[model samples]
Target: MNIQCPNCQSIRITTKDEGKKVGGVIGAIGGGIHGISGALKGSQVGRAVGSIAGPAGGAVGSVAGAILGCLIGAISGGVAGAKLGEIVDQRILDNYLCQSCGHSFSIICHAGHSEPKIVGANFFNLTD
Candidate 1:
């Protein structure tokens, strides 16, 4: 599933994809670092063993790593996403004048497949 900006009617990236993308990037980085460390220690396969060993160490470590990566990624993605949303929101407000007042107004952002709420009336005002 995906989320969309209410004001500009643009599709925004979803948390799920953001989290996974972040996790994958981090995991690869971690794995590379671990491998480097392993190579330094002469483990032959170095951190390359993580791919196979990750599961064998039980789901705990693997899950922990992924979750840790995800959390970091999600937070980072969320902040960036919010900023991007703001840009879109501003564009919408600047371009799409209010029907009633014919004045530019801020947008009210929403998530999921729900309908778009009016810019000024929603609980979470995207303008702020």
Candidate 2:
């Protein structure tokens, strides 16, 4: 669907996606914390697994496991955070920008209304 600016009827619009950004960051942080907890277990497991190779391998494995754990945690957390943030942007933030008018707005659904309406204005006073 083509969204036009309510004030100027311009098709050049940008979605703010503020919520998604925030959510993604938050989720990632939470996920990273979990990953850290997991990392300890991962390090133990890695050491045992790598020890089969040799003494040097065991030492390498422990470090590798910890790094892997941290990486996994950060990545998962970031993705989750971004997804949640997107939902917030759509549902709560004035997520649309009219390039022509520089007006920020959100598409809102009214109760018992069949169609969504373009609502709100200049929430961010943003310029590009």
Candidate 3:
């Protein structure tokens, strides 16, 4: 479906899918960073525990801790990053720019796609 530009009343509007793709990539990077951080923390804790037990125990604990930490961190980070990306896509990135008048705006749809309205100065600017 195409949206009409509020300023020019032209139907030359398109969805910005590129923004969503960029958001996803950013989210993946953020998730990877978080995962590394979690692994580091887990290894530290494991080392501390192993120090009290002995050399063999410490070695085993460190390896186990690092693996567990990495997994948990990766999953949580990925989920959080994905959610953040989606929010950015919907709120800040997703938009329709008018090719005819250079007007940029977003559309808000109510329940069942009722009362879809443009939410920018072109739609509601009393001064204009």
Estimated TM-score for each candidate: 0.30, 0.79, 0.48
Candidate 1 lDDT over residue span 1-128, tens digit each: 23233444344322223333444555555555544443344332323445566645444444445555545544554555555545554444332343333333333344332754444334323354
In candidate 2, stretches whose alpha carbon ends up further than 4 angstroms from where it belongs are 110-128
Worst 10 residues of 2 by lDDT: 119-128
Q: Rank the candidates by lDDT, best first.
A: 2, 3, 1
**Count of residue pairs whose backbone atoms collide, per candidate:** 1, 8, 0
What TM-score would candidate 2 get against the native? 0.79
Cα-based lDDT at residue 28, candidate 1 = 52
lDDT value, residue 1 of candidate 1: 29
Model 1 reaches what TM-score against the true structure? 0.30
lDDT of 2 by residue, 1-128 (tens): 55668777788998878888788878878988889977887788889999999998888888899888977998898998898887777777778888887877766544245654545434333432
Strongest candidate by lDDT = 2
User: How far is 69's C-alpha from truth in model 3 (Å)?
Assistant: 9.4
Highest TM-score, which number?
A: 2
